[model samples]
Target: MKDWWIYKGDPAVPTDRRLARLAEHRPPWRVFEGKVDPDHKVPSLDDKQYAADRERGAGYLADDAEIDLVNTALLLRRPLLVTGVPGVGKSTLAYSIAEDLGLGPVLRWPITSRATLRDGLYRYDALRRLEDANLTRMQATSDEQLLDAPEAEEGDARPADAVTPPADGIGRYLRLGPLGTAFLPTDRPRVLLVDEIDKCDIDLPGDLLTVLDEGRFDIPELTRLADHRRTVTVGTEDPDVRARITAGRVQCRAFPVVVLTSNGEREFPPAFLRRCIRLTIERPGEDKLRRIIEQRIGAGAAAAAAAPDGLISRFLERRERGELGTDQLLNAVQLRLAGAWTAPDEIGQLAQATLQPLSGPDAT
Candidate 1:
């Protein structure tokens, strides 16, 4: 069986105790009770698949400390803040855990400079709703024209202005964003990957502070309708999945495992940092890199690129000199094995293009 050390913290604490602690740390959000098709639950990897999952070269090998930090975060139900250089698998860690545990598909929010808290919470398609409403009105008019002449005569022709706009369900158009969906209540906790958070504006992290701490957010559009209706079924991140919100609020039953990844481009606020379990993903070593190569491509591919000559060794040397990201190694290997170039001189030129390091003031 694959040893998925989801939690490796505190040898002094009994394993049962750690499990119990994590179970107790449920989110403060409300439960999900709605009429809809059930969610899709992909089974966790079996022994063979698990082995394949681990051996795939792009996988991140967590050190004891990193494993401990992850376990600690799980126990405490805290958001994990992962910082690392590009291509170090900061975001992949989230998917790894989700796949290992069968936590369903991961909900990802890729952050950008213009991204904001509300952007991550929900999206209201007002324009689409309005257009749908107009279409419905036109269809109704067509149906009236097709009615028998006598029936049409019996019904007085009301002015077009008298036509009431169709109620295209507003909640139908409002879909939960990745962050909001993660806070949704469910039988099992979901995994949310917020990628490249450091690319967001300075206030983005601070804005998330409250939502993370509270584990909930409200949709005012739904809230307004809630005054008339007790429950509103709304769209979610999952396809064909709908959740019910009472009085326009969505809260979690268990806090979703939140993985916020950064590229070490910027520092976070103290308050924001305090609420998170921080992990710095160090660059993979030679053995890890070899494993990554084997995992990503195939063992045969790896052997083909690595046999006779020290391909992996040379790649590591370039990395040691801060020439390129670890992904470049994979690129180089793939090129070598594919017989892209047979001449040694041409291969070296290809390597130069593939492994060029960052230059200028930022180069280090």
Candidate 2:
């Protein structure tokens, strides 16, 4: 397992090499069998979505230490708890993994102050179901009344069950969130990105401990009717792809490669931390910043190379002062090269606008 881990700062490990290592040291299958969607097959990374992932990943520049942590998380099948400052590529890690391993679209669950564990798992539209049920009842009643009205028109006298909606159609109101959908059984595991988890309520992480540990969850609404109905088809995170829930339970055939990102805003419980494989991303140093800037702006003219190097020096100085973000540095560098600031003095003056240290209450 340790042999599979690489400490290279690059995310561009060859796919064949990765697969060979995986084949040699496969983990125990915790995968669940999910209802297959023949129509919505997982596409290759050649699409626009994967293209964006590739671009962002190349720009993010994960160090060898970060790469090793990623491999460890993949081999263990445990949720990775990534802590870093904003714009440090914590959420981006998920996309990098997806693009590198050809793991299909990453199911991203963005957290907020109001987010809850159930919000990430699945959502049941009780109000919508109630409305649907009422509509069905009215349709049934109207049909019955027409039947007893002594045949107003020949075609109007249709079967009572014709317009009556199926009671089992309640399944339409249930939709699985990214977290729940990740648990569906599949030959390959999905990448579940829990973005900005630090924004979640204190209890949210604690609430997830069980679901993460057990690799399954039950929908009580479906569970109640399990005895009456053999299988209920419910909507999944993927469009047009639905899964059947037997006994109202969703269990993963293969544990999802879950990546939960935090910005060091809050502390999680020790229990929650213990369940995860943790990694903290450090700020980009000079070499990494240079590579990142080069990736974003690209290599071309000697002027371009010099422009980024000069900006990198100033960016590092500002960073030491704890004011500007790495993204701001990229923006400054790009602006410096794009404009008609032929004079170095003019470029420096414009760069100050973006490179200036953040001030005021929001600085933190």
Clashes of each: 6, 12
Worst 10 residues of 2 by lDDT: 1-10
C-alpha root-mean-square deviation, each candidate: 6.0, 3.8
Give one digit per residue, the lDDT tens place, for model 1 in 165-273. 5453677788888888888776567789999999999999999987888777888888888768767777777766777777788777667889999988888899999
Q: lDDT tens string, model 2, 234-317? A: 888876777777788888765788999998878899999988999999888777776777667766522353455476776676
Tell me the TM-score of each prediction against the true structure.
Answer: 0.78, 0.85
- TM-score of predicted model 1? 0.78
lDDT of each: 0.72, 0.74
Q: Tell me the lDDT of candidate 1.
A: 0.72
